[model samples]
Target: MSPFLPLATVIGCGVVYHVAQKASGAVSPWPVLTIAYGAAFAVALFMLGLGWWGRGDAVRWPAARDCVASLALGLAAFGIEAGFFFVYRSGWPLSSAQVITNLSVTAVLAVTGIMVFGEHLTGARAVGLALAAGGATLIARG
Candidate 1:
């Protein structure tokens, strides 16, 4: 697998999750998320059992500090997923919500890069970011 495969998989999962959440909104968000997470955890455990999570023949564990950080990150991720499921059930259009959410996230990251990371954006990237922000605004208004 290529290095970008995981990133693509994550994006695809997000899209599918939004669609499923919209379709399953008649049901409770908690139940839906719980089932989804349970399934995902099962799959992950299965992969681990099959020895699919490490380099060729090595299984590596992180440091305690890293494990703690990862746990916090996982908690935050679950919170976001739960919140999004609820928002999906709240009658938000999938297209609008996804677009706005993605664009807003991109905008925040771009701003953070500029402010915190001191990353410089070229003229073209700046224009693209502006267009993206405008499109997200239009989507949210729709």
Candidate 2:
């Protein structure tokens, strides 16, 4: 699978996500998340029913460790969803919120990937990091 397609999916969904988040600024975040998660669960269940579960392992139930990882991911996703709601409520414009968050996440994950996962910080990645920092600074100043 081309990375660009998945990246584009995130970009497209992210645009809709932020718009919906901003639109729901008047509502409590938890209830909103609950409904959103419910909808997501339904969609996932439907997909699973369609036999499109995982990459060869989706048919089998996940192992305990995999479940644990999924739990951790859920917590992090909740934080992200709720955090954005609060950020939006606190007056962050839609234009900058996603950009800033993505940049920050990319930087942190880059460091974590290198330090924890022993991924190489190749010259291209280094340049990308530098460029991201520069872009962030410019966005923040605007």
Candidate 3:
């Protein structure tokens, strides 16, 4: 698969996700998330089945560390969903909210990717990061 495919998917979903989240902000976050996760679970099961059938991969018990990592990921997903829901409900415009959150996440993850994952950060990328931070600050204040 082309690398851009997944990036485009995330970008498209993010656009709709924010609109849906803002629309549903009147409802409690937990209930909204419960339904969202339920749907995600259903889709996950279907995808697992496809993997089993197509890739000859059978579902098996994950290792303890993998399980812990998966559980942590779930917790983080909830935090992202609920945190944004509350922030939107609290009157943060989606424009600023997404910009602020995405830039901050990008910056932090860039550091972690370099330090923990041994990813290289080029000089040009550093300049881009600085520009992103400055843009985020302007959007947040404007």
Candidate 4:
């Protein structure tokens, strides 16, 4: 599959996710998130099972390292979900909130990619990062 397909899918889902989140702003955050996560868990489990069946393979338990990484990702995802719910409920507009959050995350990930992953940081990328930060700030202020 093309990488762009997955990227576009994630972007599309993110758009829908924020819209639904804004619509549900009046509901209790925890209960709403609980139902959301429950559905996600179900879908994830079903996908796992389907993959195993299609591959005619037994369910292999994840390695310790993989398990640890996945756990960390899950924790981070929970934080993101809960944080955004509260942020939106607290009167942050969806447009600005999404822009700021996504831009901030991109900036942090760019630095992490360069520092921790030894990815090259070109001059162009540096300028882009700075501009992204400036844009995010402007969006937040306006």
The parts of candidate 3 lying over 4 Å away from their true place are 52-61
lDDT of each: 0.80, 0.86, 0.91, 0.87
Considering summed lDDT, which 10 consecutive residues are worst modelled in model 4? Answer: 50-59
Regarding lDDT, does 3 or 4 come out ahead? 3
Candidate 2 whole-model C-alpha lDDT, 0 to 1: 0.86
Model 1 C-alpha lDDT per residue in residues 33-73, reported as the tens digit of each score:
67888998999777776665554455467799999998998
Q: Candidate 3 has which clashing residue pairs, if any?
A: none
RMSD of 1: 2.3
* RMSD (Å) of each candidate, 1 decimal: 2.3, 2.3, 2.0, 2.1
The clash number for model 2 is: 0
lDDT of 4 by residue, 1-142 (tens): 5779779989999999999888884567788878989999998899788775356567778999999999999999889888888888899998899999888888889889989999998999999989988999989999
Poorly placed runs, candidate 1 (over 4 Å): 51-57
Per-residue lDDT tens digits for candidate 3, residues 41-141, read 99888978887545657788789999999999999999999999999999999889999999999999999999999999999999999999999999999
- Candidate 4 Cα RMSD (Å): 2.1
**Best-matching candidate per lDDT:** 3
Q: What local lDDT score does residue 62 receive in model 2, on the 0 to 100 scale? A: 86
State the lDDT at 17 in candidate 3. Answer: 93
